[model samples]
Target: MSSRPEAAELGFGDIEVGQVYEIERSFSATDVQAFAAVSGDHSPLHVDPAYAAGTEFGSCVVHGILLASLFSQLVGMRVPGRHALYLGQDLTFRRPVLVGESVRAIAKVTAKSEATSTVVLNTEIRSSDDKVIVMGTAKVKVRDQVRESVAAASAASAVPAGAARSVALVTGASRGMGAEIARTLARRGHAVAVNYLRSADKAEQVVQEIVAAGGVAMAFQADVRDAEAVRAMTQQIVERLGPPTVLVNSAVGEFANRPIAELRWSDFEDHLEYQLKAVLNTCQSVHPLMKAAGAGAIVNMLSQVVGGVPPNGLADYVSAKTALLGLSKAMAAEWAEDGVRVNMVSPGLTRTEMTQHYHERVFKMEAARTPLKRIATTADVANSVSYLAGDDSAFMTGVNVFVTGGQTMI
Candidate 1:
């Protein structure tokens, strides 16, 4: 084993913004299997060929969230280490990543915060071709010696102080899990940009709820799939809701229900276009702002299925979700030194519209078979997402917390 100090050992005095922290971790088919065994995400895109062959990609791919787990290692050990607290991250999957592929995680600190003890990182994930498969921003709490020494000696240290509210642009806030996620953030007192594709009514309702519940929120509509639109949306959110320091990517489409054989290439790309590209567009759009502000958080939703899942019809769905995992890890590596904490939450089966149909057919069996003896609720997943998005999980990044309830033991 290499004898380098953990990331926490590296002092902030020796680092500067824009410095690159590039690292490589080889992931094998067995590694993926191991992750699946521990995470309970046994989706076929990362495993079964019989299920993957009929999909548009025509090949099995690695689970996106499994790749995302690499982010924790990058942040917790490779880049920031002991001094880091994972604030949040935003991720986009640009391409399909297959098993046995050598992937790299790249991190660059783009922003730093003295008062909040944080940094914002610009992150990227690439394959051997140097093609970016995933991109996102990670907001990390770095130990600022100036602040630490002051707090340690100050007599008023016990007084509760209000730090500046951190914000983020979350897509797909019309309803379902995205809305719930937004509400969770608002309840945590975060200022939020409730992004909606076409659900103005739903988005507005969420806004009203946040306001009524004594939280801050605003509704903005953007088809996150469109790059230009995402750019415009981020700008609007910054103007309206203050610069977004945290981003939670919870957007998904209803088309995720079908199996691979019945899946059309257009349907596959459409999902990719909206779910994956939307994240890229938003992160890229907000990255400069996060850097300029000196801190930010980005959280991308990854599924346990990306690692391995029982036989299900969703080859394309699994492929896209699997791709997301790799993207999260790459960003965590590239952006950590810049003061950004990148991490991921691989949620097990959760009750959401996406799983409504699956719930009817397989959830009962899934719950019965699961060690937890129940499917994960939206709250179950959201709690972890919120923690990663806040100071509660400050010492984390480039890590994937398997919220599988012992489905996978690793």
Candidate 2:
């Protein structure tokens, strides 16, 4: 396994779904004997090589429970790190692990419940041959010590008094996918500016949650389509947090879905203002800050509807999104010289409050059609945005990341 990050570097807030941690060790005869001595399960198959060979033409096997214990090490020492209390585990021994064979145990966060401060991890142990030997799930409760450690780490890692940590401005972040993006960025150590047009209460709630999670964040209101409003909002963020080195243009205005024949030009114009003009306003406002920093990332949120035509009534929405894709590529090319990168994230029908009114059958059909057999969630989209916002994609620009579960492939 790779070297573990410092215990102070991790907390429940830092845990992300699909994050993996692993550790490996080779068990020896002495280890097996020690286990046998401790548990008193001195079966011949485990302690006596000759008797084991007679029965199964094999050598001594390590105790299944002994191998399973590695999971405790993984969850308690790594991953959540230092403050994980082993709640319970369910194990299934898939194959026998021979003594003297190296085994690697992996723990992956599958789900996290912030309200309860618990995380569910998928655990598996594999032999050196890369064959699974044991598989299971673990439940753990994270303690307040981890939270305190995270707060201390955040403060310790903050830039000097005059300098600032990289700030990320997320528009329309009061709810849905935008809210998740704000939280995720904060967790990743970015000071976040959560922008909302009207959801003041919800926006404050997001900021409070980030603060509670030991991250830095503040809330601001702005109509992203208005150049003056965006300028004012950006200045406010700079004064309160820092110049935004990352910008996520997720602000959206309401528009009706209507067929081209039924739609007026005003409908198309409304979407254009929402999708294209809003992106333009935020990008232009942050360009100077990014250029000064010699680096920046901009992620534009688009819709999967642009991939193909719907059955009816989405021409205006789809057209504006498609245009935004083109505009993003143009901006990428224009800003390459200034050390700014532009990208787009197109998400399929995600189950946000905005889409809750979607018919049940529509969701089921989309799920069945998707290769992953599931619809996208807000976290799923936020994960993609987080990836593009960080250094993980430093070499990438002008790319469209589809969070569609393979529903739309190009």
Q: Candidate 2 deviates by what RMSD?
A: 18.0
lDDT for each candidate structure: 0.73, 0.84
lDDT, residue 67, candidate 2: 94
Clashes of 2: 0
- Global CA lDDT of candidate 2, please? 0.84
Tens-digit lDDT string for candidate 1 (1-410): 99876455554544456677877766787887888898898888877777778888776788777767666667787567777778887777888787777889888876554335556667888888798988877877666576557633441342124423567567887787788888888888787789998889989999899778777777888888888787667656643445677888888876556776788888778767755787778777776666555556778887787665544776776777767777777777776655566677777877777666664657777788789898787777777888988877767887777777778666
Specify the highest-lDDT model's number.
Answer: 2
| Global local distance difference test of model 1 | 0.73
Write model 2 residue lDDT over 1-410, tens digit each, in one string: 87855553357778876689999997898999999999999999999988988766388888988998899778767867677777777777988888888999998875554324556677899888888889876777777675656544554554333223778999999998899999999888888999999999999999999888878888999999899899788867765565688999888877665677899888999989989998999998888667645689999999888777654688888888999999999999998987899999999989987888888999999999999999999999998999999999999999999999998889
Residue 27 in candidate 1, Cα distance off native in Å: 50
Candidate 1 off by > 4 Å: 1-164, 256-259, 358-361
For all predicted structures, in order, the TM-scores are: 0.59, 0.61
